[model samples]
Target: MFICPYCARNFYRAPKFRAVSHIRFLNASPNSPAIDVYLNDRLMFRNLLYKYFSDYVTIPSGTYHIKVFPSGNTVNPLIDKSLFIPPEKIFTLAAINEYPNMDLLSIEDVRHPKIPDKAFIRFGHLSPEAPTLNVVLPNGNTLFSNVSYKQITPYIPVDPGTYTIEARSSSSDERILYVPNIRLRGDRFYTIYAVGNLSKPPELQVLIPLDGNSYIGS
Candidate 1:
């Protein structure tokens, strides 16, 4: 069920549930506070903290004005942008970077007609102050190479299993952090997001969230 932001009416989807699109919000800003997300002046999500993802929401396809403000303060918006949504599409919109220089990143979630036997995953660099980094496997093979802040890598398929993925300095091969024993199932999509600050508290960490393309409308 969803309330139309434009009409302020509560309604359920009928036969054409897939006729609408889906979207989820991700907060990736390292030094930012909890935020309020408004679409066309209607609050859609509130108090979304850093490094967290909101549940998927169904919305009719159209252009929308996205206004992001610090929680409880609507006087000034950190970001005001117009985004278009086509029917039957799913997207993850992420807020990246610190205030005054933040950006909205739209990552499309493509629903495959047939699910593969292997798991599909991608990596993102969201640490604002981290140097160019590499996502490497235990064998030292880099899954993603030299990714800078705000960069998102293409998805790759891997065998379903538990593994420790590491973030290393690209030039020095110095280990930054490691995420251990991520159990991924077959026929799913995921994004391994590296966020937070390298120089301060809230130190760098990874976020592995099952993507909507894997289970939405199933």
Candidate 2:
């Protein structure tokens, strides 16, 4: 904090802060083998298995080319996507669909919260072969309705606690996936991602993960 001698004016370089974005990867392709994720040809996630999420990583904000492949192989990549990352955003890039027919689904996670005492959660439907669904409680109370494949709902605020959540077919009201003991802490954000097939092995399941905005600092 020094004033210029000649001009008698205060002039201090505040600081140089590079803009950045936070990102993580989620493997939701039930039939796919453990995978590798690349950003601009550089490996970001290695051997990420189904329903698993990588820890968040920070990067300079800009456009990036993303590719996903079976672990240890770069040839014949499974996915190729072009994405633009704005500064200070948090995201999860989910690898979805069965093997040999997969795509990347980018999910924007929560940022700052307007409510401090409430927890927030969203439903992300990633099952390629499932029907339009309703996110509900065990007692037939619906939270998100008519969500189809690759559809992600907006954040819903609720009391901070562990609870049972369900996914049911929107038409028949029959239960599809039962998620138990999902714990939501106050001031945090979460996404309950429904993945896999409704009629086959790797049967329907949900992966609930805390969003990066809950802890990652800008």
Candidate 3:
């Protein structure tokens, strides 16, 4: 049995003859127009909003052409790109806008067996206005440094406890964002996303959590 953290849906694997791949779509652009997604010129989703993501879709491993367009109009694609999917891997394709600029980011989601009495966590930098960031603990321990926009870190193990996670600019020690009182549980997996544009009103800076599903393992 496998579960998807994005939608909290469960799935059971069946026997297959060929390799397969899983991919999901995410809209990370704040205040941008809602969009549509297409693969191989076929519409896959419509009206996906900022900070919203879709469930994983499994397909045969191969190369694919992907396109994104504003909702209700397919004549002009905002992004067009080709991607290759290796067998038996999971990936997330994200659409991001830093106002006057729009781009796509592809992230591979990897999972492994949980260590006993410990939790695994990873971080993603999605804030466009922010510089490369350093993820630090309250004790000034750096977990990830020079993490740039659209970048994601590999999972790191830590003991289950309450923590205050902070992000600092790579060029300076000033804290850019701080998330306090995060409670992690043993044997669980989590991904923390740093989202929002620094220039936007309300500043769109936030830490979003996705509790990982343990049934999916490498």
Instruction: Give a tens-digit lDDT track for model 2, residues 162-188.
Output: 788878889998877777877778987
- On TM-score, the candidate that comes out on top is 2
Regions more than 4 Å wrong, model 2? 1-17
* Segments of candidate 1 deviating more than 4 angstroms: 1-19, 113-116
lDDT of each: 0.80, 0.80, 0.75
Per-residue error at 54 for model 3, in Å?
1.0
Cα displacement (Å) at residue 36, model 1? 0.8
The order by descending TM-score is 2, 1, 3
Q: Candidate 2 — what's its lDDT? A: 0.80
lDDT of 3 by residue, 1-218 (tens): 11123454333342488787777777777666888998899887779877777766666788889888888888868888898889878777888766326688888777677799998888888877788999999998998899988889998999999888888989987887888877778877777777786666536455444543444442
Residue 175, candidate 2: C-alpha displacement in angstroms = 1.3
Better of 2 and 3 by lDDT: 2
lDDT value, residue 178 of candidate 1: 82
Ordering by lDDT: 2, 1, 3
Number of backbone collisions per candidate: 0, 0, 0
Query: 1-218, model 1: which lDDT tens digit per residue?
Result: 10111111222342564468888888888778999999899898889988777777888888989999999989779889999989888888999886657789888877765356799888888788788998989988788899887788888888899877888999898988888888888988888888888889678888887878777766
